[model samples]
Target: MNLHVIDTGFFKLDGGAMFGVVPKSLWNKRHPADENNMCTWAMRCLLIEDGDKLVLIDTGMGDKQSEKFFSFYYLQDTITLEQSLAKKGFHPDDITDVVLTHLHFDHCGGAVSLNASKGNFYPTFKNATYWSNSHHWEWAMYPNAREKASFLKDNFECLESSGQLKHLDVSDWIGNGPFPWMNILFVNGHTDKQMIPIIKYKEKQIVFTADLLPSIHHIPVAWVMAYDTRPLITLEERQRFLPEAVSNEYYLFLEHDAHHEMCTLKDSEKGVVLDKTLSLDEL
Candidate 1:
């Protein structure tokens, strides 16, 4: 099996929103913000080459949105998804599977693209089967007022329209491998049924910490994001997952961390903290 770190690009978000109720003095020391109080973050995706299957974890925010929409997020250091795939010696057509952590615009935007000539939206990965659990799919489709803005229809509706969307059954596995060599950890705090992939690789368990743990700074129990629907549930999820990650010595693959690529957990007097940081190649 082979894993590739597909860096789609970077974007800036309000530091306050990212760190929730945590004081700026605290999180600012770790993830220093700019004059605008915005912190830069990476839209890092993962590509898995396991035998015949080529699975992509998430697609960063795409270029289909209007300039007005993008101005709000301050998207920068941009790299197109297609360009990133080409760098890996592959193309959108090469992907066999796409596992979206959730339907948030930044995470799944690149999953679909505009067919400009046709005046319609279409799946970017023409031959790939897009995977999203039914619960999250429904949540995204009929989004609540708070999250409605993030669930862009153009980013995901095309998958279902193209007859390529597949839903995973959450009950099939508790903590076991659900997709060949990867296990699915269903989390609800960030959004209903956000799926985090726990991949078994080379004698180590590498977990894709989607939005549950956006960056190393988020390893602390109280650093939950303000964007989460249920902050308390996110706290409970982190408390439960971190200890297990520490015990198993799992390598956490961060999705939104701008500088850090990956890190292992260590049990400290305070709680579980980052052990060591390394890139995916170092794994």
Candidate 2:
């Protein structure tokens, strides 16, 4: 199996929102913020080349939203998803599967795109089957007031309209997914049922640490996003998942951490801390 990092570039979000409850003095050391109190984040996706299945995991926020909508996030250092794929010698047409970690605008927005001919939105990956669970889909469709801003209908509604959307069994949410070389670990703290993909490659496991651990700085159980629906649940989920990550030495593929690509965990005296940061090629 082959793996590649798909860079959709960076955007700015309020640093306070990214690191909830944690003081700026603490998190600022790890992730510095600008005068606007915003920190830059990467929308790094992953590409899996396993046999005939060329799977793209989590497309970043696409450029379909209006300028007014984008002004809020302050997008920068951008490249289209197509350009990222092409750099890796592929294209959107080459993708056969798309696993949306969840339908938050940042994670799944690129899953759909504007169809200029029809003057409507459609699946960006025209040839790929978009994966999202039923529970999460329902949650995104009828998002709570707190999360409604993050769940844009234009980002994903067209998957169902195009008949390419599929949900994994709810039973498969915890462990052992239908995918031959991957497992699913669902954590509800971030949203209803955010799916974190655990992939096996070259006898090692790579955990796509969606929002469960957005960045290495989020290793501490207390350092969760303010945007989470249930911060307490996020703490519980992290507490449960970190030890195993240390024991198994899972390589964490961070989606939002602009600086670090992959990292391992170690049980430190204080808690589970980052062991080492390495490029995917190092694996």
lDDT of 2 by residue, 94-122 (tens): 89999999999999878888977889887
Score each candidate by Cα lDDT: 0.92, 0.91
User: What's the CA RMSD for each of the models?
Assistant: 1.3, 1.2
Top of the candidates by lDDT: 1
Alpha-carbon TM-score of each model against the true structure: 0.97, 0.97
TM-score of 2: 0.97
Q: Write the per-residue lDDT of candidate 1 for residues 62-131, one digit (tens) a residue.
A: 9999999989888884677899999999989999999999999999999999978888998999999998
Off by over 4 Å in 2: 173-176
Instruction: Give the runs in model 1 whose Cα sits over 4 Å from its true position.
Output: 173-178
Clashing pairs in 2: none
